[model samples]
Target: MDNLSRRDFLKASGFIAAAFALWRCTPREVTASVQPAPTPAPTLATPLSADDATTLTRTLRRITFGPLPNEVARARAIGLEAFILEQLNPESIPEPDILAPFDFETLEMNAGELLRVDPPGRPIGELMGATLARAVFSPRQLYEKMVVFWSDHFNIYIRKGIERALKPVDDRLVIRPHALGRFHDLLSASAHSPAMLYYLDNASSTKEKPNENYARELLELHTLGVDGGYTHQDIVEVARALTGWSITRPRRFFGGGGEFVFRPRLHDTGPKTILGQSFPAGQGVEDGEQLLDLLSHHPSTARFISTKLVRRFVADEPPEDLVTRATQTFQETDGDIAEVMRTILTSDELRASLGGKLKRPFEYLVSALRQTQAEIEPNRALFRYLTMMGQPLFHWPTPDGYPDVAAAWMGTGSLLARWNFALALAFNTIPGVRVDWDVLAGEASAPEGALDTLSDRFLGAPLPEEARSLILDFLNTLDAGFVLPALGALLLASPYFQYH
Candidate 1:
């Protein structure tokens, strides 16, 4: 599949119009580890459907970063539910090949080891590079997708001092391990993560005067929905319950210092009532642990988290019926993430939400790389381009990560930026990345034949007739050498292509 020949290209051209348009369509199930979501907003574009191959490919488009042909084939071979089960248990999949070559220097480092390194090694850069590389090359697509979701849900700004070093370790230890495991596990891991402590100011929270930063966000943002019905006093009580849950900053290890610590002396060992539940007067670290337990199982937490999951995988408004069903799954299973994901993926809501999502800037960039099979490296180009496109990795200044709805990202400027990127990538113009024209073009040297292959490659089925004609007319004006590549670019930048 990687090396395309003239014969194969000709054969693929014949498949353009028939691959996805109206012909014997049937729906199928999908899997998790997908992308963004925010508070409910507008519904999405027209949902596309065709035959089994088309349905499977489109479903893969939802769960994975732009579906590679090989991934599509594997899904067909194994069948949907089996493949989703494998993705849910990423441990069953062999380790990704990226582990050795794309190594981030601080991946194995604890907070202390990272602090000892000179200049800090740009570990954040290496970590991000690895992340993008995995998006492109890893077979553990659903696992990687879940990591993206959890990373955003428990976001930590990398620009902060120690966080530059600590965030990568947090990704390695806390987030990735439990991304698809269980909600309670994910919440507890975030609470214990030194990076989270540092980012939220919980590290300095004390018994005498506790900080409310983490406490407020933990209720309003993390667990309960904004309207989840907690009061100011509840926030204060939650803050008091979290005192002395800090980092061990003493200079003990060679790499410098910082580990999760429970300083009993600094803790407020007083009676506390949170959400109408009482805590005994003298407890230690268990006070905070119990808080996590309470919040993770709360009815509001279940609904809040269920709504986000539904939005991320299904649609913008998140079907009321689906949210209620998923909430029950969350509560019934005690926050089992994998089961909840399966429930969401196999629902009628997802089947209706075929082409309903607008790709966020990050998804747009990463999916382009995945489709074009770009040879990306850890460099300033990705950072600059990602920033310019308006969704720099882990750089949202506010605690509420990048807006996941179309309204926030559908402005004229961001759309134009996306178009420019599509053109540059299709034309092989980006530095340090190569777009193989031969592999992309195949036997289609002329504009007409080129459109068939281009549509087949990018849009899965044939391009709609109107789009096909406009693209063909546009290609005719270009020089002979430019037609095939330009055809690829036009298809990528089209409005229809943006929704999936």
Candidate 2:
């Protein structure tokens, strides 16, 4: 069993090619007639059926990294509406001390303190580790998912100079605190972040020479969509309004740097117009604050943010009606993130979107770790696999962050990397990560029984009879000792596991 090669494993699971073909050609039922719940409650509007149960499981998969068995039972017990409410208010959920195993000093440090760490890159590494740890182990699953979403939405590359030191602060103060709060507050916090200012060269912007990097992204990526009505002059004026939003530079020892500071001397101090609104002259920091307020509450921002949320939770191409409704929720609630998410999550669109979205590399890795109940130490060894899969946390060089579409991730190299990871994890070859195969297998000792059990555990449903027959036939060829790991790896790498 220990000596089994990957080639042998693949050969045994020869039905993979056919499974993939069926997955591509088969049409899914992506239309449901369910109505949105007006509010979160403990009751359902209708009786739950097998299809409804499957839809709830798929919905859980969409919101969380992946649903553990206990989570699935809890959702079934309380119903999806109540579950959504509980997740929306994450303060109600008591989180396990998942970070106790990792001794990362940087999680608590301010940017000024982070700059002085002995090894320069240690802080970034610890940040990535803690992020993965939370995704895999946190009880507040939906809150963590929003953290990932907003992290991508307001991305700052960690490799940039001094940003390596500043981003941990941004992740702590700017992103996490307001991830589920109001959009205006989150936008304002990001506008004032030292990490963002440094990453986008806003710290060096001045009245004489304003940098448009942050301003351009603020319009195109952050708030307004690319097609959102804005001319080149709008970006220029926004940049001018944001001038003098800089980070402090320590002059003497312990003077303290890496804090956001407004410098009136560097500000434009003149009138500016943006998006058809004018700012009167002589305003200092209020200009940027006003700009954030305008952008966050803009109708375009509502539509743009709503589209991205639907794409994340519903489908690659978002449903138009859901987007419109979510936009209305955003505007009506004054950009309340939790209410907007409620609108999206409780909608029939999400239920109809079952198996419609593909899991990105990071989601795939985390889901695997979760489904297997893998004990992890959260270190570089695990991150190495993510790098191989092309989604190393905080490593995207561009401000747009990682791609969210299936086409961007369904390449040969990416799929191969996923297969290799499945093999490594099932064989217990990854350092600082281990899966107890016997416990995962439960009472199913025979190969046929083990296949059904593991399929339900991993995919939330049993495999089709033909596919099950093919896998069991292959398992018959393997030695008794090699059956469980091979079966587990085959299921993980299967096409069914590729989507939520």
Candidate 3:
């Protein structure tokens, strides 16, 4: 996973080969030649053999944010096992027109937008809107999800004004392009992204005034484990090595290229040691590149990153053996993400841990959108919902970003916010998203029937009879119109529905 070796691998194998080669092997079922047309949509209720359930769960969680009605049907038609393989190999999947609704060029805004007529109204809102729109409406669901995953990994704060606007571009360029590619390239790209540079203060970091914020988090959060055996001196050395890497001012530079520019004058010429390895001295930005290489290939990084992937898709506390296996794959494959994913997807650990991890706020938002067949017009609602859930888009306050642990999400206030969100989403109270109330209502009879249909629509199966009865009882005292959305919301917020 060293930079030189990873780049060499890319050069030797081509980008496609680099991506696939880095992926650890997955034991996938042979794809049936007769793939089904994309219609009638897939669902969990579709009779799956016991063997298919494990594959189906992985496909639903990883292939896209969550499976919409049509997507679910397509999975059933193609066979769940084949669908998982296709998602893992996204390059083979033709680029789908998911961003059609988003005007990526004009929609972009940074601090410059603040100087406009309405200074108080920031274009950051619009930037977030475009992002959410793409996530919910775009056909390239897997890419969108990976973008989200990497965003959290290299979390930046959008509240930083103009600089925050660059994250979308960074996502498209730095993160998305190599999401499933080699982990080393991805690490280097994130390090050099204008968004990361500015957000972490690398833009202002100088030899005399080294900013350790990005450096510390880069090790603690981005690459090596929080418990990685690095010291304060190591962090300071890493920061010193990164001094002089700044972004071109949008207004001052080459027509807003807004890219990272290395200033040798601002860089530290003094030799430094990071992770116990000393650079001979006199290297400038290349020193930082070398540092990233060292960190990317570190044994701590492999285990740390692998455990995170497991947490995202498998279980809260993934098995030690699985993590070891994934870490081994990461090392052997030179940080190939697809290869690491192949290892996890094909393992007994993940298969046994399926349905154990609670879906995060962003995951919940995407899943709700998928289940209800909601149409995204502006995409502001998705961003708004994410904010309401305390996970605003590109707005993590610290360089360390949002937490992955369940404790960060639980509590009375957080639970209340989630309940309110669930209700609003189902009732169509949120702006820019539409749901078919009539179609939902027509599926069932009494309030219980309505509840049952809602369970199927949002939860992927019929409601538990007791849960159905409880919802029906709640509905008896309310209007039917109110009943359906309320029940729909309740199911979405259900404990059972929280985990994938």
Candidate 4:
């Protein structure tokens, strides 16, 4: 794609774009009364200037899944303002050649048939492994993070037939490219994709026996948040609007297929009203397109999407003021995702909310990988750990995607599972990944040094004096080999580690 200047880009678009630019012109003033939240201790924060350190930590934790060692160093070197500008606009960074390891052509291979076979070759399980490996190992950090975000936004369950086969292509084409683009365009693209149609049961939704499943989710889960103002009747009308949008069978049992086809014969040709807006309606694919456009601009869509972004990058309950600003950005930019992110990241409210949110399983896994500098090979072992950790790839049973709250992951079985994984990971018991416990401990005969070094290595700086003493006391009784795993387990299960 040719590079289009933001100035020119804004001018070509309509009034919505103008409103967004105007909103951006307004400056926010920080107040004295608001006490800034503590940063995620040690790892994500390094006690620099309080003001700059707070901004840097929130951006680091929010934008990428924790920072790579090089990235953190680079951010510190370049300073916070420059880092935020670069991340919010990574198109300026040339697309890195990191995807050469995977067979892109093969990923595009017969997407429908693979889902039909029992024990699918690259079920969501395998895909999740690939995703984690790439995100951790690839230099293309921005693309990977956007893919993760888009995947959650337009979630699809791989358990559905044919969808398991189709997800690889869905990731590469339907989601990734549009991850940072206009929401209207992305919504339209997803609505037409076979993976989405089949996954959500829209492929089977027909005129005579119209199914409301995909339609309801498209509005409720994918676009407008549940609380976004819309009635059940809106979902029905949207479903009717989406009638006849389906894909054709692949030629020769899943070798290759034609473009998605709109079978007007199967379409519900009736007048429909959605979100208080009426469509005279027809028997064509325009119904789906119109609905996507409408939802893309709805006030509820802006608030829903912005709030979700806040939850993901900030705290579970992000400040209403931050959400309001981000939502305003969304509405103004006509849902330009990068701009919405910029609004959130640059805000004082976001900087104030760091360390208050719990890390979801994926973030926890990635952050641990970065912290330990673990090497991933064979990849399935890492995949298995994610499953055991309760956040398997693409395998969410419902299309709503994985839950982000701490309650979902802090259960007894989950915590125990995390402890076992942490032990294995630190001790190099998990296949294809190894951590150097000896080096991690070095020549420290005393538990204090070992615990302190491990704390600094994993958590960024040394632990607090009390935490250090507690870990050393716990470690003093264990054998040398047992010392590393015991300390690792405690660190992984710490309330501190859980938040960031």
- Top TM-score prediction, candidate number: 2
* CA lDDT of each prediction against the hidden true structure: 0.75, 0.83, 0.68, 0.68
**Worst window of 10 by summed lDDT in candidate 1:** 21-30
Per-candidate TM equals: 0.89, 0.92, 0.81, 0.83
lDDT tens per residue, model 4, 226-313: 9888888887888888889888875535456624778899998888888877788554777777788899999989999888887777
Q: Quote model 2's TM-score.
A: 0.92
What's every prediction's RMSD, in angstroms?
Answer: 6.8, 5.3, 13.9, 13.1
lDDT of 2 by residue, 1-500 (tens): 23446765564455345335434433443333322222211111221224767778767878898899989999999999999999999999988798898898888887777778879789999999999999999989999999999999999999988887789989999999998999999999999999999899999999999999999999999999899999999999999999999999722346257889999999998999999999999999999989998999999999999999887887777778999999999999999999999999999778765665678889999999999999988878788889988999998989998888776786777877888788778878788889999999999999988998888888777776655776787778777877887788778877667676
Candidate ranking (lDDT, best to worst)? 2, 1, 4, 3
Model 2 residue 318 CA deviation in Å = 0.3
Superposition TM-score, candidate 3 onto the true structure? 0.81
List clashing residue pairs in candidate 1.
25-50, 33-145, 33-146, 112-255
Residue-pair clashes, model 3: 9
Off by over 4 Å in 4: 1-59, 94-105, 110-119, 123-125, 252-254, 281-283, 437-450, 480-486
RMSD of 1: 6.8
Tens-place lDDT digits, model 3, residues 13-86: 23222212212121122122112212211112221123564356444755577676666777788876576667
Output the lDDT of residue 342, model 4.
83
Question: Cα deviation in Å at residue 372, candidate 1?
Answer: 1.3
In candidate 3, which residue pairs clash? 23-338, 23-339, 24-339, 41-73, 42-72, 42-73, 98-138, 110-162, 111-162
Give the TM-score ranking, best first. 2, 1, 4, 3
